[model samples]
Target: MDVLLTVVVPVYAVEGYLYQCLESIRAGLTAEENAQVEVIAVDDASPDSCGLMLDGYATRHGDLRVVHLTSNVGLGLARNAGLVEARGKYVWFVDSDDWLPSGSIRAVLDKLRETEPDVLLIDHLRVHENGRLQTDASSPMLRGTVTLDRLLAVQHTAWNRIMRRDFLTKHDLRFPAGWYEDVPFSNPVLLAAERVEVLDRVCYHYRVGRFGAITATRSERHFEAFEQWDRLYAWLDATGVDQALRIRLFTLMISHLLVVAGNDSRVHPRRRRQFFRRIAGLYRRHRPEGYQPPVGTPGIKHRLVAINSYAMYSALRTGYRVAGLRRRSTERTPVVSQDLPSAPQRVQTTSLR
Candidate 1:
């Protein structure tokens, strides 16, 4: 039987999580079901023993294939390497630091058989360090509709979506190297896809707040977010996506940039002002004519950004941060706080490990 899905996991220093991640791929599936799935774990020259561990695991499990790179490439290029080795009809990129839920493989296979969509969007929950599970804020929005605007509105993580191999290859949709690489790759796949389906069930568990994890750590590389978005902007101009769609994308871009700039975890306090100014520069260059900002606090932010008011924005951020701290102290549940405009979750293009 031919492989129906190829699961590509880019592994770096995820020694603690790699075992569970690989095991989850075959957890609830029978031998026959497992036969129809190909697992490729790319060891991106991990500094730990992950490469050696992968070799041993592949030897013990005949179906698992391991790719050992000579040097550490970031997450985007590592996934691209795994894509080249995939032979299945469809491909799913699973992060090594995360794992699939039980029976997810069977669920995905069944969905693919039923819909045969060029792109399949799946729901996921954010798994906190304290064992709390919070549904992705965008989960409710994932439905039968496959419009480009709706697709763009959903979270931009690659792991939450499964794509047909031929569709990706035909469009030459490979991830670019740098942070926020998903910005360029995920949007274009959705835009070019002819058929799309959504599996509303939670198929994956996204690990959050893990020590040394990409989304959790502070890094100057967050600046790459602007360049990555620029890549998509270039694509939009080249493809001549409709003016309305361009506006929608532009709105999303501002929201995403604000999220990054205001995020204390991603951008350091010292560099926050610089990041905000850079975002304001982007706003001036790309803000659509006659564009109306969204309502509420986010709208206020858009208006502030329009005038390049970093001082005002910083004051507003201070207020939000104070309010968020109060809420956190009162609430016991481990909730991921969102104090900025509604946008896709901030994803790191580098290895989560």
Candidate 2:
């Protein structure tokens, strides 16, 4: 029988949590749901024992398949590999460190069967280090069909959603292998989607570990985020996505850059200033002729900082330099807590896919 859904999991150095993630998959899908489920776990040459564990799981589970990568390609490439190999009508990408709630697949499939939407957004819980679960207020975005403009105005994480494989393939939608890759890929998908459904039920549990992820490292790779944003803006202008939608998209992009720049204490003052200036210039250059700032109760500090542009950048630089100096003088390590429960091991099974 044809598969109903293909869940693509990109594994990389997540050996500690891989078993738990796979077990969540097995336990989450009911027998009927399991019959329609096909899991494609792509191991991106994880330096840890994750590849071995994945291989073991494939050997035991009939529904699980493992793809071993020779080199460490980024998450975008790993996800793309899974996408190309997927045979399900619907595709869902889950990070190896994250897991879906029980019956999540069946819930998504039920929505897909009823709405037949190009994309389905589902709510997710952000699991913190204290083992506390926070209901993301942004969860409502998964409730029903929404326009591209509306979706862009809120959160924009690519995970926690189910998408039709045909829709993605037809539009050539693939994640860009760079920092903040979602910005470029997801915007276009949103614009191209004919229909989108938002499921109110929480399906994904996002584990926010205390240990920083790739995004925490500030390096040349982080600069790639700017390139991704530029490409997205160019695409919007060239394709002429609804003018209103374009405005919202532009505002959101600028807002995101401002927040990042303001929060980054590692950026040099000169570089930070340059970054803000560039963003402000882009805003002034591309904003449509009658563009007016939205009036709200109060603008966020980052948004306010973005308004000054250069000044904000300079301030960030100064703060970063002081923080760096302080760190050098103190020779002290900050205390951090790691209190989340350990992921459970999985029962190995043979491949059924």
Candidate 3:
């Protein structure tokens, strides 16, 4: 039978939630769609029962297959391995820790047939430990019709998206083995796609503030994000995107730096200066013509960076610490990528939390 979609699940140390993820996948696909759907679950050397659990599930479902890796490879490489075995016309990358809503796969398959796009973007809900579900505001681009110009404002995330296998192969896209690898892998493909569609329906649940989640951990490995940004720039330069797209991409890059150096509480307070300096250097290196930061916190950081005012940056950051204002850049520093934890601040679990 011809396969309609191949779901690639990369598992690593997600044993606690792996069962829910896999179960969601199984239940979402109706029995009628069973033959048309296949799952490629990669156990990336998880030192837990995940591999065994996957094997057990595979035994029950002939359409589901599990690949056991001999050694521990990061998420990016594990995804690359899954791509090697994908045999469907469309490929969906589902994180092992996250699950899809009921009947999402069938809905997505219907949407795919509606317009065979190069990529289909689905809406996602961020679920916190407290059971708080955050559905982002309705997007104009996702509604009615979308254009590349409008998509410039939309962020490119790896998950909650389905890509044509041939489109990905044509672009020769591969996930890099490092932190924030999504930047390089997703951005280029999104920009290169001739037909991109965004669905407003929430299909996936992205969990935050969950124990053992990669995002929940703060460490120097976060600095690897900078390398990811550099890779993104290199790809953009090589592909020769239009000037408008280049400016938009640069704007997002600048915004990421501002968020990391200013508002992200994961950064160590001692390393805030280094983070600021790095952001400054990036802006200087990649600032495109007619570049102006978006109004608000990011714009403030841009003004400070323009003047090379580290003193202003420090003073503003200190104000945020003392005033206890959220969403303001220059939060208690260390920015995880620094390879150090915040000495002044440790994990604080409050009653409300």
Candidate 4:
């Protein structure tokens, strides 16, 4: 039987969550549907027994294919390894720390058969450590007829979308190495696709606060987002996107950078001003001709960046933080929080965006 979908899972130090992640893909699939799906799990030189576990699991499951790498290649290149082995009509990259919701695969397959889209976007829930699930703010935007600009407004996570094999190959949209790799890859995939469709359903359960998860950890390497966005700009120039698209992408780039800057988990408090200054520099460099900032808080942020006023930006962030604290205090509700690294300002940082 011809493969309809290939689910690529890149495994690293996720031994605790690997079984659930693998099982979720096959959970709601029927026998016939199972035959049409292929799963490639890449063991990226994990120090744990994940490679051995994958080998054992592949022996028991005919649909599972395991790729053992000689050395750790990080998340992006590990995914590339799995992609090289993908043979299905469409490829979906599933993170080893996340799992699909029940019947998600079936729903995806149905949509794939119906629309035959070059790219398919799906909604996902943020599964907190406390087991609470929250819908992404961008979920509502996924509905209706989605254009490239609208799709770009949504999150750029690779796991939320499936790409037709030929579309990816034709564009040569391989993941780049290093953090924030999705920044370049996901946006370009949406831009390059001729036919894109939205599933409009919560198909993925993205686990937050997972131990050893990149986003949940604090590190200086978060600066990699800058380099990644630089690559995206290079792609935009190479593709010769229209001015309208450029304006939209520029807005997204600043918003994403602000998120990185504000997230205390990602950026050190002492270096946040430095990061904001860098964001301002990018804003000045990439601001399209005749570009007008959007209205409201985001507009104000864009203006601040344009002027390179890190002090004003910091004040704005502080104002919002104060308002949030007042609002939460009025409610007087106990918070279920993740275990963050011990720092003086650690308690203040929790999903600013």
Candidate 5:
């Protein structure tokens, strides 16, 4: 059967919630729609039973194919492997721990088939561990015209988008191999896409807060976030993108650095000083002239980075912790202790191996 939409799921050590994620897809599609859907589950050598579970599911569902990797290549490579095997008009990515709301598959397929966009953007519901549910913060700006600015302005999530398989292949878009891989991949897709559309509906049910989740834990690998952005910058710059858009990316770069630093509490204090040394130089190199951080604590932190002042940033962070004001955002209640915004979760990938 000619596939209409291919759902690529990268599986890792998510046995705790894998079933719900897959069941949602099963429950979402109708008999007719299911016929045109192809599900590819990439098992990243998960030590857990996730791979075995996927194999069993494939036996039951004729359209679902299970690809088990011999070793763990991280989420980026796993998704890339699936993309290589995908034979569908459109491609959709769903985290192994996250699920589709009932009927989401059908709704997304309808839009993809009708509009036939190079990429389709959809809103998601973020479900926090504390039972807090918030609509994606970018709903207002993600819709309407498909300008480079607006598209770049929205969340850069691989799962929240459905792109034409040809569009991705034609552009050679693939996720980078490690932390913060989504942005480098998503940004290019957004930039290359000729026609993009936003579906106002909330089709994705995203789950946050796991004991070992990426947002919850931070270590040396976090530095890869910058390297990821640098690769993206090179890609965009090669295309001769407008300077204005490059400035926007620079602003985003600063914001992401702060957010990554804020989310990380596991680093040793001395190591952080070393970390800041390397990142501060990057901040100086990447920040556009006359750029200011967005208002609030994150902005203040960004200024510290801009000035290359690790000492000052440390002092303010200590003051906030001592004053018991570190968790507060300038806007609303933060889903996580991280000073980041209400954006989509960047670490929502397979937890295998």
Candidate 6:
């Protein structure tokens, strides 16, 4: 029997969340659907019990297959390994710490059967640390058959969609093995896609873990983000894709980098200026014609701030220092207010020992 979907999970030292994520994947699939679904868990040389847990899962479930690596590789490499090992017709990438909502797999499969699109985009729930929930509803984007350019402009995350295996293989699209890998791969995938379907259903629950997660913590590895952005922009310039699409990709890259710089404290002042200069150069070189910036507060400022390297670096350094001082002052002061909301319920989902 041919498999319909393969769920590829790249596990690192997320031993505490592995079982729950697997269970959520199982629960998301119906009995029949589960039978057709192959769960490929790639252990990226985790120091914790994640590798052992994956071994146990493979032993118990007939559909589960665990691939253990000897050394720790980044997320993109693990995902690429899973892609190579996948035998299903369609592939869905799921983070080891995150899981799909109930019946999400079946819903996505149904949509896939109906549309038979090269790529299917679904909604996702952003689970914040403050117990706030945000949904990436696809209705607005689902008005018509979306072109590659439009899809590139809208969705950036690879986890929220199910992509046909042949399409991926044909174009040789693999995630770049780096810290910010998705940006480069996603642009190419979108450019290669002929027809993409946007399903409004929310299928993914993205857990926000502040301290331990990759996006939250400050690290020097973030400097590589600029390199990936440069590669993506270069790829767009070389490809035969529409000029409008190329411009959109460039703007999106610059805007995203600015936001990352704004939020990060570890990025050095000189490096921030360098990133800004690179983006400014791209903006001038491309000079996207009749390009209207997206509406909203951050949208306009993000573009404007990205245009000037010195201004951005200065503002970023000042903001970082101010935030650091504020945090220190708050720590020194006693708790004076009781009106603040309580922290969200934190669930420890697994046990390594």
Model 2 alpha-carbon miss at residue 146, Å:
4.5
Number of the predicted model whose TM-score against the real structure is largest: 4
In the range 1-353, model 1's lDDT, one tens digit per residue, is: 99999999999889999999999888878888888999999999999999999999999988799999999889999999999999999999999989887778888898888878898888788888877777776666675444667767888989988999999989899999988889999988888888878877778889999998877779999999989988998898788788888788888889988988887899998998899888888888777766789899999998888888989999998998999999989998865764312123422111000
* Candidate 5 lDDT by residue in tens digits, 1-353: 67898899999999988888887786845678888888889999999899889888878876579899999999899999999999889999899988877667877777777678898888788877765677666655655444567667677789988989988878888888997889799888877878877777677877876766675665777778778888987897689877777777777777666656655564556677776776778777666655667788877877777778988998998888766764553448545543313223332111101
Report backbone clashes per prediction.
0, 12, 13, 0, 3, 0
Which candidate do you rate higher for lDDT, 1 or 6? Answer: 1
Query: Per-residue lDDT for 260 in model 3?
Result: 66
State the weakest 10-residue window (summed lDDT) of model 3.
344-353
Q: List the residue pairs that clash in candidate 1.
A: none
Q: Please rank every candidate by TM-score, starting with the best.
A: 4, 1, 3, 5, 2, 6
lDDT tens per residue, model 4, 205-273: 889887778897788888898889889999999999989999999988998888889998889999998
Per-prediction TM-score to the true structure, in the order listed: 0.91, 0.81, 0.87, 0.92, 0.86, 0.81
Stretches off by above 4 angstroms in model 1 are 144-146, 327-353
Compared to the true structure, candidate 3 yields what TM-score? Answer: 0.87
Q: Which residue pairs in candidate 5 have backbone atoms (N, alpha carbon, C) closer than 3 angstroms, thus clashing? A: 12-352, 13-351, 13-352
CA RMSD, predictions in order: 6.4, 7.4, 9.5, 7.0, 6.6, 7.6
- Candidate 3, residues 40-136, lDDT tens digits: the string is 9999999989889888888886667888899988899999999999999999999998888776777778778777888888767777776666655
Model 5: lowest-lDDT 10 consecutive positions: 344-353
lDDT of each: 0.85, 0.72, 0.77, 0.86, 0.77, 0.73
Off by over 4 Å in 3: 137-141, 263-265, 321-353
Query: Model 2 over residues 67-162: C-alpha lDDT tens digits?
Result: 999999888889999999999999999988888777667677877777778877777778876777776765544334545555665467678668
What residue runs in model 2 are displaced by over 4 Å at the alpha carbon?
142-147, 209-212, 265-271, 296-308, 312-353
Q: Number of clashes in model 5? A: 3
Top candidate (lDDT): 4
Candidate 5 vs 6: which has more lDDT? 5
